[model samples]
Target: MTAPVLEIALLQVRPGQTPAFEAAFAQAQSLIAGMPGYVRHDLQRCLEDDHRYALLVWWETLEAHTVGFRGSPQYQEWRALLHHFYDPFPTVEHFVDVTPGRLPPS
Candidate 1:
C-alpha cells in the first residue's frame, strides 16, 4: 500500500480576524473530511501568536489532496469561506513519513 501524505499549511490570519476565520473553518472542515483518500485533519492555534495557525491533514496519497481535493468544486467553497481571512496567504506543502514505524501509536 502507498504511504500516506501529510499536508502542512502555516496560516497567518489578518490581525483581529481569528474569531471569524475559525468560525468559517468550522464550516469548511466538512468539505475536506468528505474527500476521497482523506484520512484526518487538525487545526491548531499558536500560543505565541493568536493570529497564527497550523493546518495539518493526512491523505492516503499526494494526489488525493493536490488533485482530488484542490481540483474539486468544494475547494472553491473552501477558498471563499477561508481565503479572505488570510493576510499574506498561507503556503501549503506535503510530506511523506521518513520513519513510518517510529511514529507512536494513536
Candidate 2:
C-alpha cells in the first residue's frame, strides 16, 4: 500500500474576512472530501493572527491532489469559492511521515 502524503497550505485571508472565508471553506471542504484518494483534512486558525489559517490535507498519493483534485472541474468551483480571500495566495507543500504514527488522526 502507498503511504499517505500530507498537503499543507498557509492561507492568509483579507482583513476582516476571516468569518466569510471560514464559512466558504466549510462549504468547499466537501468538494475535496469526495475526491478520490482523499483521506482527511483540517483547518486551523492561528492564535495571534485571526486572518491567517492553515490547511492540512491527507491523500493516498501526491498525484491525488496535484493532479486528481487540481485538474478536475470541481477545482474550478473550489477556486471560485475560496481563492479570492487570499491576499497573496497560499503556497502549498507536500510532506511525508518522518515517523509513522507520530501524528494522530483527527
Counting clashing residue pairs in each candidate, in order, gives 0, 0
Candidate models: Cα lDDT each: 0.94, 0.94
lDDT, candidate 1, 11-81, per-residue tens: 99999999999999999999999999999999999999999999999999899999999999999999999
Candidate 2's residue-wise lDDT over 1-106, tens digit each? 6568999999999999998999999999999999999999999999999899999999999999999999998899999999999998999999988786575444
Over 4 Å off, model 1 = 100-106
Global local distance difference test of model 1: 0.94
lDDT score for residue 76 of model 1: 98
